[model samples]
Target: MSIERTPATPDPNWDRLVADLTAAPAEKPVGPVLQKTADVPVNRPDLLGDMPLTPEWVRTPAGWRTRAEVGKVNSVRAFRRWVRRQSTEHGHGAQVFRGMHRTFLWIQGTEGVQVATARREVQQAQGDYKTAKGHHGRRLIPGKEKYKRRAEMDKAFAGSVTAMSRYKAAQRDARTRRAARGALAAAAVAVPEGAGIYLIGGTGGVIATGSALLAFALIGRRTAGGELYHDHDVKFGDTLKLTDSMLNKIYRDAKVIGADEVVELLTPCTLTADGKAWEVTLDLPSGTPLKKALTAKTGVASALGVKVQQLHQAPGDREGRLQLRVSLHLPFTGKPDPGPLLDLNCINLWRAIPMGVNLRGQEVSTSWVERSGLFGGEPGAGKSAAANDLLLAAALDPTVALYLCDGKAGADLTPFEPIAAMHDTDGEPERLLEILEHIWTVEIPRRRALAKEHGSRKLTAAMAAKDPRVNLAVLLVDEWSSYGAAADRRVREEMERLLRLIVQQGRALGIITLCATQKPDADSVPSGIRDILSIRWAMRCLTPQASDTILGQGYAAAGHNAQDILKSQRGVGIYMDGEGAEPELTRGYYYDDDEVDLILGRAFELRAKAGTLPAGSVPLADQLRAVDDDDARVLAVLLDTFDAHLDGEGEPAEWLPGSVLVDALADAGTALSADSLGRLVVRTDDEKAKRPWLGSRVVGYPRSRVLITVRDRFGMGE
Candidate 1:
């Protein structure tokens, strides 16, 4: 390895090569000099031709190549033009070839200088080629082998293609064979056995013509005969010559249409089923166009008699129910005939009972027969039954005490016999009268006392619980007229006093009076009695006057009349509350004997618990009761008040003139003569005269002196 390698003698050609590479006359370096004159000036060829013929640097004695100082190289316009042309023509797509050469040189040595020199060689080659190529259109053209495989593949494809004429000819032959086979098969089945051949015209020709000709030849018929035997084809607009029976059949097949009903259909259509076609020609009804049939002359559908309504005209396939608009001729009305008012089924007289028995058209549910003193009507005109119904209701309602007085000999009041004590003519009237009097003067006070004792202000509870002597008394009198009509003047006076006090004050005391009579004349049924009755039920009376008397002007307005009254029915009545009441004909509940008995029996049971009535009947004990003289005492006081106040007359000295007591006293005393009284016109009380002395504390005024009347008898406190 110590053998020294001798340096090769420097070839004269090497030096020439180095000089040619470093200072090439063919090209110029790129960069500042080239950039300024990248477009070569046509006028500057001299700068490029006059190239320096020396190497850029030479190796000195120190064995190092020195770089030359070439400062500020001026641009040569012609050279730049030449350089630009060379780069554009050859710079692109030449790097790989240049790199290959450089790499080859580098592999020959391992010196730093060698790598750099190799790189310089690659750059110089690239730039020189770029300069030459850029001046002209220079590009690498692919060699013949570059597309050798593609050309081969294309040749193989061309060799494999068949001739177009031959392929088309084969396809045509196949199609011809298929057509021939189809024709042969169709010919075999063309004439169906026992089936007639029919021809239908096509767009240009007729179908089944061959079959018709074949049939004519087989039958040995002439062309005219075949034509005559052929069936005719029917079409639209053909007049159908149908027989009577056929017409009937067609009519029978027609759908039956309902009156006032309409059917709509899609027109200009044909029905197809199982390859058969049927023609349906439509004939509209003899009216306006269907869409406009229900429309008005104004085209607003006003003929239907409804408001302008809009309906959807959408296709029928949509999923929703269709809304139909119709204007009916009229709404519904009820016709009812008020018929006979009688029934054998008296148990529930309220049901199916005629309107006549239905109390002047008043509904039974709102009859008010149970509420006491709420009606004003005739006495015999269902008042008794209404009163009985009220009593029955009260009997059912245990809160009220039932007190019945049949002053008309207890006949009409007998229906209340189960609960109320049925009074007779024996001694009960006087006793009841006395009871009523006590109710006013004593019972009222006693009730007041009871309320005070209990620290409560209500009398019903205090009296009902504490006092057995008084039930919630509803004293019914059949003949309230009897009180005013009493033959005994004293009894009449006492009865009037009782009636006035009770009718006015009995309501809060729970004493309701239900009195009836055959007559409702002024004296018989006074205004005071009528005022208390807010309810009135008048039945068929003897006159219109009676109806008018019970019910005032509004009676007819409530649909009540005298002719429509139920004359024969037991519990029929026209009810009115007062003189201005609207009379209503309503059925008063007519409870039968058994119903009355049953209701009254329950009433009695309740009464017995309240200790209002005895639980059982007594044995045969005919005991005579003694009458109390207190009745005479009460009657006497009443008679005295009536007589003295109403009939008496007197002078001014003894009492005020026109006072009732004056008349009675005068009637009791002898009639004074005017002559006898002139002497001592009236004797002074101090000088007692022969005349029975007047029982009066009054003093008189002196003659010719006016007497002053004083309201305060003795002064303020007095």
Candidate 2:
């Protein structure tokens, strides 16, 4: 049993007690140095009364205000004597060690509070940068001048990103190898007299002492790596047998980088690490900037020969927090392998779709079922490639309908236009606003109505099988910040409201919205929305702050430094799934242009089999069948639709309505019309003459086809 250790509280009458103790003693002046020292024995009769009430003191004019300090000394010695007696009488070895570890960690926590400034600075810097963005609306005050302001923000952001990347890397390395010094030595306990030594030569010790030693040494060493532990002949005890000894040694020698940038022991013999945990908590050295450890972390860890996770070691509590806790899980310098490449090309879409390989080399994946996602990275940082990786998976699913959007000149998204249910690429604020409105007034309500009818919250696969309209509608937006920063006030406000609604309620209705951006700022993506994204991926972020922005707050401090990833490592990033607690460094599956064609081809085959194709969606295979069947007839009608009917005057009209085009095609002996191929793919008026505009007018991508049939299905456009 452990001894009661309730500490004595501060005296309410402290002044009176001090005065009474210091006054001209009616009995004897005990603390005259020699007087008390000579009288107090470890076994004194009043040992209990002599113990120090508290572990603090106040000074006087002579620099010795507190009286009875001498008794404190005797009290400590008497306690040690009592502990030894209890150990001998009760064998409380485990309890004694537990007390030691607890006391040591408590002391370390006190010290750790003193040296946590650098971490505080990092957190503060992150907050301040975000605050500055919020205040400026980040030059949300835009016009022709907006371009210039944006350029300036970009430049400043670049510099900050570079500096943070370096800092994150340094801090990460510092925590990886903090306990790697001190050579190991081992010896067995001494055996009593004539105890039979269980050596190779058990019975013949006196014949030749020196010869026996040589014989034992030769027999004990293993031929493979000369490892003594693996050799049965060796008598050394396993390290586990001496875990307590190892724990004490680690705790005793813990250190931090000192003022002069030198590794200084901060808790030598002052704390005890738990044997099982193998963790040390202790005070950091005074005046040592946490940066010292960050900068010299590699050298210190390498020298110490102990590889530790900086996340475990870098936490701090206060400016005066000199205390830090560190750990080397499984000890030494080993790391787990991340494993083999995961092929996600043909996996079931209902399952956790393969994302990529993570830091531990394990294949990571995310479930798209009822979850929204955020993809964050720098330009050419594999965001497009990863998005395609997702598209490949979704396309393969029978119950998924893709909606594509890109503010870029359309090159990034044009290839997949044929496959999308709703596609938008125009840089026009009005066009994007219209698309959001269509979804808000059309798709959202229809899905909600279906959910109500089915008595379901989320449209599961079973529900989708029963109702074709319950299939997943994936809305993908590229360059999201540009949409938010649009000069049009109406577009900006309305878009924000719809985006929030989609995020808040779309999951239950099978409308999953995923947006990719070059940068994630408060102004670009609302912080509130960013926090709830079920999946977050960051690849090659410019700064640790950006990494945290995508992954969540305090992610950078824990050393998930996605920003440190190099631009060259395309398709490699960190990913967090909704199901997992921790974020992981993952490399997205790489798919080239050719591979995309192949995946899309396979998706076409799968969707054809499942009969989940949207109304008027003609697959590439059907297009081939049309080529063989009614190619000539359809071609003639397509041309007839564009033939000019001078509107009572000689001037030709710029565009014809969908009903007009459909009638003209019917008159030319072609049953197919704009409704059959609508919202699919027509770029120019000249091209529309050849193919007829197949996309909706609401989302006017230069090469989009909008079907009046598809839109009017949801009560859009009258």
Assess candidate 1 and give its TM-score to the true structure: 0.33
- C-alpha TM-score for every candidate: 0.33, 0.45
The list of candidate 2 runs beyond 4 A from truth reads 1-348, 608-718
lDDT of 1 by residue, 154-238 (tens): 5434433323333445456555655665455445445442133433224212234444344333433212223322112211112
Task: Give me the candidate number with maximum lDDT.
Answer: 2
**Alpha carbon lDDT at 669, candidate 2:** 58
**Clashes in predicted model 2:** 42
| Model 1: lowest-lDDT 10 consecutive positions | 618-627
What RMSD, rounded to one decimal, does every model reach?
49.8, 35.7
Evaluate residue 468 in candidate 1 and report its C-alpha lDDT on the 0 to 100 scale. Answer: 49
Model 1, runs deviating above 4 Å: 1-381, 415-418, 421-432, 451-471, 552-564, 577-582, 614-718
